[model samples]
Target: MGVFVASTRPKVVVTRNLGPETMPLLLERDDVEVVVWPEDTYCDRKWLLENVRGATGLLVMLSDRVDAELLEAAGPSLKVLSTMSVGYEHVPLPELAKRNIRLGYTPDVLTDAVADIAIMLALMASRNAEEVTAVVRNGEWPKRPWSPFMFCGPQLSASTVHPQRTAGFIGFGRIAQATLKRLVPFGLTTCLYAGNPATPADPAADAAHARAFGLPRVARVGLAELAAESDVVFVLAPGGPATRHVVDAAFLRRMKSTAVLVNAARGTLVDTDALVRALRERWIWGAGLDVLEGEPVIHADHPLVKEPRCTLLPHIGSASIETRQGMAKMAAENLLGGVLGHAMPAEFTGTK
Candidate 1:
């Protein structure tokens, strides 16, 4: 090599501090110029705009809104936009499409972690884990003797001769497979899934996934069938125009009287008002929600809040240490790939 040119390095801007593990990967590259935010929190809009002015790549998080303003600020040099979240609702796709910018997102990497949270939500909701723990902490449990059926909740793994258990999915995907696998031991033998049409590989791949999980059958059914047949229904779908309020009053009415609902996905997929009415009217046995519609500011008078059977969480689906680290690393890789003129390892193709 006669003379190595340092001018070939492309500029990359990270919107947040990716975990320590990912720092080495970006630093090791000579063809990439990486600029990381010193703070552990989200980067300020002004700072981001200033830093991203001449950058070729941007690695952002769900918290950061990559709207037209941010994209316009990045100018002609920008080649790629990557987010660490599976949900790209925050990004403005139309603007990116106009500029021919490639997008990257971490999807399958955090699937198992999210599914684990979904299962935990179901278990906690069904067993009244929150209230029970509160009672003990407040010294109420010690004051009173345990009575029959007092604080008792519906059994998840009930033994039966026929084993007629059924689970439903609002949006079935990789995380759904992991959740189904965990529920198999609880005598769950059937599943009903309802959502948008399968992708090119979805039909065959879904069947294989179902079989591998030991589920007796996994059928793509309508919303009504999912509501009526399932003992527990998990909402794992994406949030957007087509799926907004997919689960409404009409769908809730069809659910089995003893059924439970769990949602670890987007809040927009469910009608909070309709869900409140359903819970108030006892249409379903209970509900477990990690994500809420109009979150961080839920109405105090919300019906789900008053309903004893409802369990609410503040959306910590992918909160695990390992999963979050992986997400950060993948996001960094996406930015680095764009900066280095290579294909992203987990690029968001905007298929859906």
Candidate 2:
């Protein structure tokens, strides 16, 4: 009689340490073998390629590029790719689709977290938190003179007695709408959004959104109008070739001097060079940003870092403990489902 042996279990390669809350989801699974980078930071590219040679599943982060090179390195056994992010710009869709590989991502879970940050950025920029906080941090407040209008920029709030304040959004999607809902309580009277011209407008939906927020005005307008009229403008547009550097020199020049700019979206959407020039030239009041172009590689002498009028965060929009854990759990489920030939909890279905 010939002796029989069991087949080896499929492997899943994770880019980074998914933390205590999420790591167990895969570690506890007896059906698959899991390999993690074991570091809190980004996984080394060289190590990733070497380990993913025969992985049936890959759990990646936004920092890891899911391009042709990485896909090819993963070999024929690579059946699923999951990322703990809402955006899929880092993933090469065409390549994944061509290979018949399933792709999964976390989306709505981070919407509220990002929206909260957007509002925080708006206040930080408008209130000159960067400069004022620096005064105290550098111990200059003791020596500095104070005045009533010393740091005044613009008010985010508007009352019935005061002039109405308008909040403009570059892309009025889920996050944008959630942000608007928050702003409604802060006395936001008007809302304006500018979306892709290719996408047909829905007047009925817009009307319903306006009614829900009890805003007197909510209209879809062109970029020029949004930049000019907005008291505070939020750039929530997706990043790609089409929307790259949408807020360039021309758009900056059109904005009101008192208008504050808040960008929690992709960094490439706003040209960094143009923004530096705008801040230096005082084209607008100030700016707050979470994501920036060429981030994680920013030098100490980077131009934005030196600019006092700009408040910058190192891409911590969805860093809330609850949201991050939720995203990771969702991503793990997605990878497991795809590997088992089941429907993913949140599969990428291409752009609507």
Candidate 3:
């Protein structure tokens, strides 16, 4: 790799005002000049393109697109780029490689936060909180009489009726492991996960993982088995072409009718149409989601939004105050390190 530097102080174009916790890392430094988007929302493309001309470093959120055009706008002076997100789907990584620009991203800091949301979604969907709460909020609760099964839904905790509880993860990465750790107190007995087919199963590792979690069984199984056996399937995988629509009609059909689906991962992982049909047909108990295929544009009339059995959150898996501050600090550090030609705290290596 080559280290490129400018003759004058490095100029960094930040797509958002990363807040007080992170502004000092760049503003206080005389070595770098910071240009940040003044808006409370995502930076405008025209404004970004115009300002990025002479920048040596750039800090962007997930909404910003980093492609060949953006690189052309940035010129050869651009030596480094950082995104304040774990997923880099918005960025065309090869474009950065072609320009010899180092890339940095914050990943592990939001693991626990995202895992917390996953469990919260699971609980919300399992308990029918969204629908029942809506009835109360709409003034329909007072009109209705209490019954034996008025709002009864599936129970998440292991109980007398269900002695054994199995937890399934679509992709068992850091977030998935954290989710499993949280599920331990819920009296989970088994943990099943699906992995990349290219990587063969390691029974020894699986056994040790199960032992660490105090679970009797932990196996790497096929998607079919994972869907059919799991009581609550948590999708915590990465998003891309290869993994898109992993939860299609076939996968949904294979799931237990009593099971609930929770997706904190990318929306592309699940087919929205298929999920809508699944919920309508009662293929599964309910669903909880933090992301959608075409988000921020999802209207009130969107099919998923209308489904009472589905609980939707506006992609707030990592929206906690503490987690956001940590991510902001990390993103600032990454930008400073790259601009100074030093080691970034969380530099991205294009490897699995």
User: Which candidate number has the best TM-score?
Assistant: 3
For 1-352, candidate 3 gives per-residue lDDT tens digits of 9998754877899999988887888899888988999998979999999999989999999988888888999999998899999999998888888888989899999999999999999999899988999999999988989999999998888999998999889999999999999999999999999998888999999999989998999999999999999999999999999899999999999998989999999999999999999999999999999999998799999999999989999999989999999898999899889889999999988984
Provide the clashing-pair count of each candidate structure.
0, 0, 0
State the lDDT at 324 in candidate 2: 96
- Worst 10-residue stretch by lDDT in candidate 2? 153-162
- Tens digits of per-residue lDDT, candidate 1, 3-94, equal 87656567888877776788888878877888878898768888998898888999888889788888889999999998989889999988
lDDT per model, in order? 0.83, 0.91, 0.93
Which regions of candidate 3 fall more than 4 Å away from where they truly are? 1-7
Model 2 misplaced stretches (Cα beyond 4 Å): 1-7, 159-161
Roughly what TM-score does model 2 have, to 2 decimal places?
A: 0.96
* TM-score, every prediction: 0.90, 0.96, 0.97
lDDT of 2 by residue, 28-91 (tens): 9899999999788889999999999889999999989788899899998999999999998999
Q: Name the weakest run of 10 consecutive residues (lDDT summed) in model 3.
A: 2-11
lDDT of 2 at 309: 81
| Residue 56, model 1: Cα distance from true site in angstroms | 0.7
Query: TM-score rank, highest first?
Result: 3, 2, 1
Q: Please state every model's RMSD to the true fold in angstroms.
A: 3.8, 2.0, 3.9
